[model samples]
Target: MTGPARGGADPGVAAAFRETMAAVCAPVAVMTGLEGGLPHGTTVSAFASLSMNPPMVLVALDRTSELLALVRRTRRFGLNLLGAGQAGLARRFAAKGGAAKFAGVAWEPHAGVPRIPGSAGFVGCTVAGLAHGGDHLIVLGNVVAAETTGDAPLVYHRRTFGTPAALPEVSG
Candidate 1:
């Protein structure tokens, strides 16, 4: 039998919502770009496939974020799916300030985009359009090139980083 769904209008509903959402696991990724010859990036879980026919993807960035401004002017960016061992790289890019997050981060150029080496996969794309969504900007991209290195991806769940283990096979 299934259990009854549980939800309520508590005073701390927003925090509870966030806590509950944090339990939903997602793959980690670092979105990078070059603005005025300086590298910039941020760790984001808001990346997803938008279309397969045109090979497009979408990433949401805070409207006020510096990275968003750079993407607006540059019109190109790269998405690097972090490997299970690249948590440090994710944290580095997540940090804000004058620190150079690209320092010591292995990368190469792909379709004029900085593709992070050793990632599970990378996609280089040019911005196709931008739309205002609430307090964020949804940037749609047209894929130019992509590559993979056969590494396991890092996952986020329950407000923490983790890797998924293979589950036992099930038979009908």
Candidate 2:
């Protein structure tokens, strides 16, 4: 095999795991919540649909994430799926800015959460459950509301921001 084996404390294991995950093309999004009635958000790639019958989703946040505290307090959050043109926004939210991130950003209150304009999709949710997973906490949510504009989605792959491309057509 390439890197270390799947076992004990080899430092390269962490690096190898990160490198492997970096090869995955994941959607870029901002997970937002309210603190003191003000908005706080952070960019994340670890989001996914968990259920369809009841409309549920899961997002993994770092254990030290400030927004995680907000979700714990408010029991609500918004998943804002970014458009391909929003790489700048994704970087902005990825930075360390509590309420300051929304300073110049134009967003509106929608279904009890901050909804940024021009996103590919938005999902307003109530925190349903929490689980400890290594260095991250998986937050399960029941989607209370959702919307989509059909915009091209932003994605991250190979340690860089990007969008997916369609495969070439194959003629019979």
Candidate 3:
């Protein structure tokens, strides 16, 4: 990678940054919103809880992503945390098919946003603020509703989808 990648960042630095981040496991999720009563979503791994007092979360979406634009206007969105067994579903949303991606998938509106069934967790949020990041926009949301299914979460590591496991304890 000698030149810039698709987002126009230095390829060398971008590749290195990606590889470095890949070493750390991150949760896999689909950020979902509605466009005129039609569901739209995309896979995202850059989301995290920002605060507990006010119950806030933040997700980073590509600046040019249609889902980002939709959420901006709707002022609401859902984060469906994928379970360990939902790698195929993750890829489905990650692919570039637009509205066509939800053709055969199952989801419904919950707490004013679309929620995918059988996910590890779900959180419906209202957009609180937005900030510009390099190549991505940080959306700060006030969590309105949340639930968990207690399923093991899917994770991304080393450019692959996987499940997290506990390490064996060691004593000397």
Q: How close is every model to the real structure, measured as TM-score?
A: 0.88, 0.93, 0.92
lDDT of model 2, residue 147? 95
Residue 121, candidate 3: Cα error in Å is 0.1
Best by TM-score: 2
Please list the residue runs of candidate 2 whose C-alpha ends up more than 4 Å from where it truly belongs after superposition.
Answer: 1-8
User: How displaced is residue 51 in candidate 1, in Å?
Assistant: 0.6
| Candidate 1 regions with alpha-carbon error over 4 angstroms | 1-11
Q: Ranking by lDDT, best first?
A: 3, 2, 1
Which stretches in model 3 have alpha-carbon errors above 4 Å? 1-11
lDDT of 3: 0.93
CA lDDT of 167 in candidate 3? 97
Winner on TM-score (2 vs 3): 2
- Which predicted model would earn the best lDDT? 3
Error of 1 at 167 (Å): 0.9
Residue pair clashes in candidate 3: none
lDDT of 1 by residue, 88-139 (tens): 8878888885228887777777777678878999989999999887668999
